[model samples]
Target: MDFSENFLHYVWRFRSFDSAELKTAASENLKIIHQGFLNANAGPDFSNAKIQLDGTIWVGNVEIHIKSSDWLKHHHQIDDAYNSVVLHVVYENDVPIKRKDGTTLPVLELKNRISTELITRYERLFLTLTDFPCINQIREVDQLVVDAVLSRTLVERFEQKTGAVIEMLNNLNGNWDETFYRFLARNFGFKVNAFPFEAFAKAVPQQIYAKHKDNPLLIEALVFGASGFLNDEFTEAYPKQLKAEFQFLQKKYNIKPIDATMWKFMRMRPQNFPTLRLAQFAALIIKANHLFSKIMAITDVSKLRMLFEGLPVNDYWKTHYHFKKQAAAVSIQFGKTSINNVLLNTVALFLFAYGKHTATQSYINSAIKLLETLPAEQNAIIERFTGAGVKIDNAFGSQGVLQLKKQYCDEKKCLSCGVGVKILRSSSNHH
Candidate 1:
């Protein structure tokens, strides 16, 4: 009766009104001329439902409602959708309903006819925990349908990403530059460690860059800005070396440094903490002064990856972004896949966040390229779960599966899921 409650699935599987030989409780023989797409809301909710009572043929649509009173509750009396409605199908038929001309609507009570197995399955799906709500159904449905389902999941995945982007836009107030930077920082940490990275970004005041624009001082600032090393008391030589450099920059650019705890390195792999992230960020900034400008017009994945090839970190970055007890050489690299992932995240964030403002899907191609090249058990698992169709596409596509697994299938909320509606109805009548 509540057509909004996985109603489309029920209609598709049950063929609820398809058998014209059937009759409603009123003894009117039923004949369905058309049943619109499962999710149809526009035009007519339910298409032709021709029936005959006492040998007089009637031809019109069937209007579905959760409760008989919902007819009046939805203002359907004045609604044109109700105008073509010849019969009201409801789970409960306590109240009477009428059309504009005051002919009482014939009622079809479906509660008893509805499969208990389907209802029970839904109840159980919501009650239990599982990896996939209808994952079990995967082997049964046609491969093509499953493929289509994943494709729909893909768009749905992007839809969610777009929603998040909209939220970010509201927070950033449409400033693309600041939005990209903040989003980048947040994304660098990934979902597991995003807040920590954000705190690191907020702590590294940009004044460090303003104060030491000269190459050496700038490099030192970049390193110290992230190391959690800047907060320590400086010796005479420390101030002398840095201050001596600062004096030269002072004439050209007013230099003042703010103290922030150098990023924590204890117990962390030297490459995994704020020190490395800042170096990466700085290398990126130094290599591309107007980085985003170069690619604002680019949506193609392959071309985007090409654009990023071998852009160097600042020269000083070769020797140090962090001066640990022992120093090393300049051979560090961000995995191609890693960079691709980052770009995919940014691209997806922009595309989805921009909403109707941007329509091109080159970002999708770009993501696909990045994901296709990445190596990981998790990535492989996702690619496998989605099946070997187009392969892992991007941060949006990869994270989308994680989102679904976390949000829907994990909780077994099948009654609320599209696939659940299809499967539960069969399982209800299943012996």
Candidate 2:
């Protein structure tokens, strides 16, 4: 079986291997100490494991399975990999698994041996009956313990971001700023509207960013690129003028204009469509042309806010980006809530990325601080992530959210997550 991390932990906790005794088949007195399930790869599937057997303190790999028979069913034998079987654990022990050399491998079956509370915790968490795991029990883990686990989870969070970063890198031509913008745009949709904004960014290429460097027209190009209005042969004067401009720009840059669907306006106010968001994004960029450099330089949260304060968009855009009713033309203005939400999230991720060198604590603190700076989140992404804005909970909550979101929640990797591992291990250790 191409067993993922889930069954591995289940096996370890249940100890399907000869739980009858704490010794391997080789007369080694086996002792299980630390149990980890995050960093394991080829040999044993746990991160940092401490197991002693035969009075010899040995540490290498510890593999877990649903049944002892899985050792061969998963082809662990004859693979030369089973040779490192310091301990074989399983949830259920039916038949004894023999290595290729014909020696009974050590097995621990945990059905009757482990604690009841640990198992209950696991069930409560992975089964998803509530908002969070250990809601009542979470408080039991003192502040120090919570901090330790959160820190570990944060590291897990970083490891998780590495994949997205890699994928994002593939999208951009190795330009960090381009990748940042694209991600920022996608994040605006908060997954529900992600593809729409991504379509927006692609339709308005980096080449265009150059063309409109000093002018907001490039911003307009990006903002309106995914609105689908450009695809129509409208007799409307502004539409016709934009089309004419697009034709010239298209020829100049060899870029194709994207005709992606607008993010839904159904049930949404007119201000929520592709038009307004694009305008706001345009204004933010125009206002803060040196945004990336500023973000990298600043460690203080207030400093970050100062960088973005200059971008309220010129009067012409504040009310018009989203709607235009002839004589009552509205200029588009990016509300403080939307801009700060994006900036804070960006800063959090940036600090998370660069935490090794600088005071990661400041990054964490800044994330918390910026929530107050932002207007209670009116946007969908922030609302979903932070539970309706102006979050009072500290970065500890943020760390949990980072993992709970990025790993368990977003990708459904709960089975392989540290939280999931915690469930199984905690179950095995239950009272």
Candidate 3:
């Protein structure tokens, strides 16, 4: 049928073949005492399987393939690792296989043992022309199972996403506040200019900002100058003053600006321009100097949201999206949606990462609770899952679904996925 080797592994691992009259190719009576643990690494498909053959018990690894000839195709004949395999299971018994010791290995062919209906169901579900493999039947799965899967996926998502933050923590020599500052700086870019913003923050270290924290004007000058925004001549009074101030500060700090070409603005909304974001970011620095400590102390989500809301952006940014470039006056307030995004991405992630680093469960619990309190995010992936009857009403559910779509569905690792496993098992004879 040209199915993948993973499908055969799934069938063998789950014991989906008929076992009423099991026998080896040598016609010896066989019984399975225990189906070994599935191995994700090299050397074996399953390990330490216990089986009875010809009334004698044997304990060793088990290897499975689509055809018996695959043992030769994989060159297992010469590899000493395959010598411990007590049973050679295959979908079809096309040829006999010899162990590395030159002894004939016991073969268990399952050509007619697996049901045709089960194969067809797997083919239809996994081989479908859709991003979500089981979308059509997702609604039929039990709600409790869906919730359980989502909860697990949510933890997986947190683990996957927080890895970069922890690596940054290590690179900063375990400076939590400085690490948080850089992470917050990256998220301030909001994905469009995240790289340049992070580079800009690295170029102008937080210690430099701490020196001039009381002076909001110098902080703005350093942020803009280090971002390469103060390089051009400005005719406007405010930008001219900022340029003059940055020229002195840039020499004092010995800071070099990142490439101006790093920032992007095409097809972007004016409010999301990097210049406005930089001004708001400088305002945030002026407002909160040591932000990581404040975040750790606050458990209430509302207070956390308050940290990003109503930032004191200056009048120049309130009327302009760029330095010396004036646009129609717009409210330069960071919108509610943007505030929530910051809370979710930066605040919750740092809390979770810090909790894991210090072995503190309260911080982890607070992180999850904050996500549950926030509203669910709307995106292309969330929409598809919601359309498939999956209930995702909070950031917790949305994050889990996002992880599921990216890790499981896109990769087509159905055998390892909770929802895919449930559907496959229900469709088969396995319990």
Best by lDDT: 3
Candidate 3's TM-score reads 0.94
Pairs that collide in candidate 3 are: none
TM-score of each: 0.67, 0.65, 0.94
1-431 per-residue lDDT for model 3 (tens digits): 86888888888888877888799999999999988989999987999999999999999999989899999999999898999999988889999888877899999988888888888888988889788999998898897899899899899999887888889888999999999999999999998999999999999889888898899998998988899988888899877888899999888879999988999999999989998899889989988888899999997866898888778888887778887667898778888888888889999998999998899999999999999988999989999999999999899999889988988999988888888888877877652
Cα deviation of 121, candidate 2, in Å? 5.9
User: C-alpha displacement of 129 in model 3, angstroms?
Assistant: 3.0
Off by over 4 Å in 3: 234-237
Name the better of 1 and 3 by TM-score.
Answer: 3
For candidate 3, the 10 contiguous residues with the lowest summed lDDT are 422-431
Ranking by lDDT: 3, 2, 1
User: For model 1, what is the alpha-carbon lDDT of residue 145?
Assistant: 48
Mind giving the per-residue lDDT tens digits that candidate 1 earns over 38-113? 3356634566556565566677776776677878887888876667776677777778887888988887766665
Which 10-residue window in model 1 sums to the lowest lDDT? 254-263
- Flag regions of model 2 displaced more than 4 Å: 1-39, 42-79, 84-99, 103-136, 188-193, 216-251, 260-263, 310-331, 344-347, 350-396, 405-431
